[model samples]
Target: MTGLTHHFLKMNGLGNDFVVLDLRREPLALTDALARAIADRDKGIGCDQLITIEEPRHGGDAFMGIRNQDGGTVEACGNAARCIGRLILDETGKDAVVIETLGGDTVATRADDGNITVDMGAPRLRWDEIPLSEEFQDTRGIELEIGPLGNPIMHSPGVVNVGNPHAVFFVDDADAIDLERSGPMLEHHPLFPERANISVAEVLSPTHLKLRTWERGAGLTRACGTAACAATVAAIRRRKTERRITVSLPGGDLTVEWLPDSENGPGHVLMTGPVMLDYEGDLDPALLSGAAA
Candidate 1:
C-alpha cells in the first residue's frame, strides 16, 4: 500500500470530530491498524472516529463505516452521520440525504437553522436487542449498582440500544463522578454482552439535561449524539424529562425528539446538531504502512 494517498475531510458535529474519507469511487482496504494510524492524535489525522463513505448497496445516497480510535468497528455513530450527511448535501445540493451504516439506515435533513437533523431510527429496548448477557423485564432500571451496598456511587441505570448499546446513569451532577474510573468498569460489566456506552446524565429541568459520555471505544468525548438520544429516551422512560428536550454536553447542545409509536408507524429518534468542516487534506503515504507492514 505504499505510495497510496487518500484525500480526507476533517469534520465535527458539536465537538465529536471525525476524519472522513470518501471511497465511493476509489475503494481502499481499511484495517484495524490503518484505522488506528488515522486516528492517532499525534502522528495522524486526529479524530474520535474514522469514517469512510462508500457506494450504497441499498437505496441510500451512500454508506458510512465507522472505526473508533481504538481501531474497533461499531454499528452506529450519530455525530458522524450528521457530518457525512452535510457533506452529501453539499455535493448534491439537496435538503435531505440518506446514509447506510452497519447499524441501519439513517435519514438526514438540512434544517432551517443551518443545522442537520438525523432520524436515528427506532431504539431497540429489548434486553436481547441491547444484547445484555441476561434478560430483564424492564430495561428502564436494571439491577446494577456500583460502590457500596448502602451508599452506592451510581445505581440502577437505564439501558437502550440506539444502533448500539448504551447505559445511562441518572445523577444529580454530571461532572461529579470520575468517568475515567467508572466508565470502563460499567462498560465491561457482565450485564452488557456487547459492552455499552456509559453516560452520566443530570436532568436540569423537564426539558433540559446535562450529559457526559464515555464512548465504548473512544473513551471520553466532548459530545455524543446517540448518547444524548439514549439519555433523553432513558429520562423520558423514567418520567424525568419530556419527549423533546435539549441536552447540553461539553462541546455544545443537541436537540433530541422522540416520537412515540402509533398504528401507522414505529417510534423514531431525531437528533439535531451542527457539523463543521475544519479542513481537507491528503493522507501521508507512510501512514498506510501501519495497515500491512
Candidate 2:
C-alpha cells in the first residue's frame, strides 16, 4: 500500500467525471479508504467515481470496477460504461466492445454520429428485483411521499432497476424542486433496502424530458447515465413519453431508448452520450496511503 504510484486517466460523460486506473497490467490493491482518497477533490484526483479497468472475468474486452466517491463498490454505472467503452474501442480499434461489470455485460458501440451507445441490458421491474422493503403489486407507482400526509410535495414515484435501483418522480417542473435537500432523504428511504438513486423528471414532450438526479453514493451529480435510462423506461411505462427521447441533465443531454420486446427476446435500454478526456496523471503515494486527505 505504500510507495505506490498509479497512472490514471480523467474522463467524463456529460460531466459525471471519473478517475480511471488501468489495473489490467499492474494490479494495485485498491481499498475503500484508498478509493476515497483518490476521489477526494481537495487532496486527490476528484471524481464522481473511481473506475478500475481490470482483466475481464467474463468473456468481454475488459472488466469495469466502480467505486463511488464515498468509496463504496457499486454494481453498474452507465456514464462510466460509455467512457470505458470508448477507451476500449480506441485501444483495440474496434467498432464495438463489451465491458463487464457486477451488474452484467454492457455492449458499447460506435454510433454513426460519433458518439458511444451502451446497451444497459434488460431492466428489472419486479418488486423483488428492484428489492423494495415491502412488496408493491405495481412498481410503476409506489406509495412513497415527501411531505404532509394530505398534501405531499412528491409522491408515487415510478421505480425501476436499470443496472441499479432508481426511483423517478415525474413532475411538472424538475427545476422547481430543491433536490439538494430531498435527494439524501429519499436515497436513504426505508423502503429501499439497498438505497436507491433518486431522480426528478419533467416530461417536456413525447421525445424530450428534463431530469436531475441525486446519485446513491455520489450525491447530486451533473449527470447520471443509469438514472437517465431508468427515467426513460419509467416515462414510457407511464405513457408520458415515447420510448426514444432525449434526457436533459444539468451537465448535458443523453439520448435513451427502450426497445420493445420482440421475437428476438426481452428488450434492452440504450443510452448514448458524449465522452471527454480531461487529463491524465499519476496518483501520489501519500494520497493512496491515506497520509493525505
Candidate 3:
C-alpha cells in the first residue's frame, strides 16, 4: 500500500449504506476497475456506494459525489446526501448544509423530527431529458412494460429523471409483484440509454404512497430518496395528489414536497429523511489483500 492516505467514514440513511471518502482537500479519482475492487465485499470493504466529497460549485455547503458499486457514475443519491450532511454537521456543528451533485444543488437542514430535509431542486420531466430511446408525447405515463405484470394494461409506468433516471409504476399492491426479478430487465431496458432505476409505487391516498425500488447498479435498495420524489411528482401530475406526500419504502419513510418558486426562484422538491451514524473503520489492507492493482 502506498499509504496514499484516505480518510473514510461509514454512514447510512434508513439502512441505505455508504462508504464516504473525504476528498474535498485533494480530489481523488477512482477508475472503473478500482471502484469494482473497492466495492467487493470479500476482497474489499463492502459498501453500496463509494462517495467522495468535493468543493462546492454553488456559494454554500459541501458537495457529495457518488459512484455505484458496479462502477457507474450517477448524478445524485438522496440517502448519501443525508449521511454526508450529518458528517459535515458533526465536524462543523452546523444545522444546515448545501450539497452539490452533478444533477444540481441540494440544501439540507436538520429537522426536529429527528431527520434531515433536503431541497432537492426541480425534477426534469422532458422526453429528451429522460432520454428514452424514443420521443414520447407524454411522460406522466410512458408505454414501457415488463413481465406478466408489464403487459401494457397491467403495467403502465411514469418515466421521470430526478437527476438519475427512474420509471415508476403505480400498482395496487407493492408486494404483489417481484421487483428483484424485473428490476434488471427494466433498468437496462432498451429505452433508457443511461439506464434507470425501476420503482413500484402504490398511492394509498391523496397524501400517502408506498414503494419498492430496484436501483440501477445498486440493486434492490430498501429505500430510495429520488424514487420517492419521482413517485410523488408523477402522482401529483397524474392527479393522484396535491403537491406533498409521505412515501413509505421497505427501509423507511421520507416526506416529499414540491413547492412553487418565488418570482426570482426556481421550483424545487423537498425530501426529509433520517441518516444513521454506523460504525466507522478504515479499509484494512487485508480486506483487499487479494485485489490486483
Q: Estimate each model's TM-score.
A: 0.98, 0.97, 0.91
Question: Would you list the clashing residue pairs of candidate 2?
Answer: none
Question: TM-score-based ranking, best first?
Answer: 1, 2, 3
Highest TM-score scorer = 1
TM-score of 1: 0.98
What is the TM-score (0 to 1) of candidate 3?
Answer: 0.91
Candidate 2 lDDT over 199-242, as tens digits, reads 99999999999999999999999999999999999999999999
lDDT of 3 by residue, 189-242 (tens): 899999999999888999999999999998988888888998888888898987
Per-residue accuracy of model 1 over 56-160 as CA lDDT, tens digit each = 878899999999999999999999999988888888888788999999999999986889999999998999999899999899989898899989888999999
lDDT accuracy of residue 30 in candidate 2: 87
Model 3: runs farther than 4 Å from truth?
2-5, 25-29, 58-60, 93-95, 148-154, 286-292
Q: Rank the candidates by lDDT, best first.
A: 2, 1, 3
- Candidate 2 ranges with C-alpha deviation above 4 Å: 291-293
Query: What lDDT does the true structure give each of the candidates?
Result: 0.93, 0.93, 0.81
